[model samples]
Target: MFATKYRVAGITALAIAASVSLAGCTINMPGSTSDSNGMMDGGMMGNNQNSSGFSGSDIMFAQMMIPHHQQAVDMSTLAETHTTNPELLALAKQIKDAQAPEIEQMTGWINNANASMDMGHDMGMGGMLSDSDMAALAAANGPAFDKLYLEGMIGHHEGALDMAQMVIDSNNAEAKTLGENIVKSQTAEIAQMKKMLAGM
Candidate 1:
């Protein structure tokens, strides 16, 4: 009886030891540390503040600006073949060069979000040109085309200003910087356009 009791106690001890060893090995398994660290990093990035500390407003700004910039690019393309003014041609090229990359940057911003929703339609106050207005611009040529382009772009830039102001107070650094750029650069362009129109 004594021998049997000792044998049973030994078996129980071995079982407990085996469980402890397994637990320790599980935690120290190859790649476990790296996997945990990776998960933590991903979690941090998924937060409202990404690597650049972007906010919901920033994402929305990017998404909305994409289509807006596209329209501007399209308008500029129209001017390329329609206008003979050297200044207008230069401005059209400038608009295309500046806005095309911006669309790509904004796209990347939206894609970084885990499940970003479409916020482009929620706030449509930006002075988007009407279909008739676009049609008018398309149908115009020479001095007429130049006038329509200037007027349409002025209104379009004004809409962008409104949108930029809406997000000027955003906590996201990139968004704030982009907003400031829009305000300053577009403001200057608006002034330039006004002067050109006056001259015409």
Candidate 2:
């Protein structure tokens, strides 16, 4: 009878040990670390995952900003063929380089959230060039192109600054970070563009 009791006790202990081992594995799963709120830590997911903490505003900002950034990139591309000014060309390249990656990052956020890419209707995205404006830009070359491009982009960047400010106060960490970055970089660029405009 005593032998049977010991055997039963041993089995219970082994079962508990196995259960704990499995639990440990789950807690230590790769690429997941929970904070006190049970939300995943930012470093673990790197803004790629759409955490529950994300708000509607976060998604809206990303969706709207993607197209906004795309326009800036398109405008920059026009400079390559339209302007021979070294300063203007360099600035165009800088805008393209900065905004293109941001477009991809925002796209990833939208995809992760299973959100629609479409703005669904005209949200009156600030500083977007009209089709006629783009056509005018495409047709122009030399100093005319440089002046138009700089002025158009200044307005575009200002619009982006407004949009970025909307989300800077949001609770979403990723969105807030992007917003701050936009405000900082674009603010400096705006100053530089103003100085460049003054020269011309």
What are the clash counts of all predictions, listed in order?
0, 0
lDDT values, one for every candidate: 0.64, 0.69
Off-target runs (Cα >4 Å) in candidate 2 are 1-53
lDDT of 2 by residue, 83-124 (tens): 999998999999999999999988876666555677454353
lDDT of 1 by residue, 1-200 (tens): 11111112222332333233222212111222335433223222211454435544455556567787888899999998888999988888988898898788777766664324344242433556767777888999999999888888877777677667535776766677778988898899889888998999
* Poorest 10 consecutive residues by lDDT, candidate 2: 1-10
Off by over 4 Å in 1: 1-52, 115-117, 120-122
Q: Against the hidden reference, what TM-scores do the models get?
A: 0.71, 0.73
Model 1: residue 4 alpha-carbon error in angstroms: 99
Judged by lDDT against the true structure, how good is candidate 1? Answer: 0.64
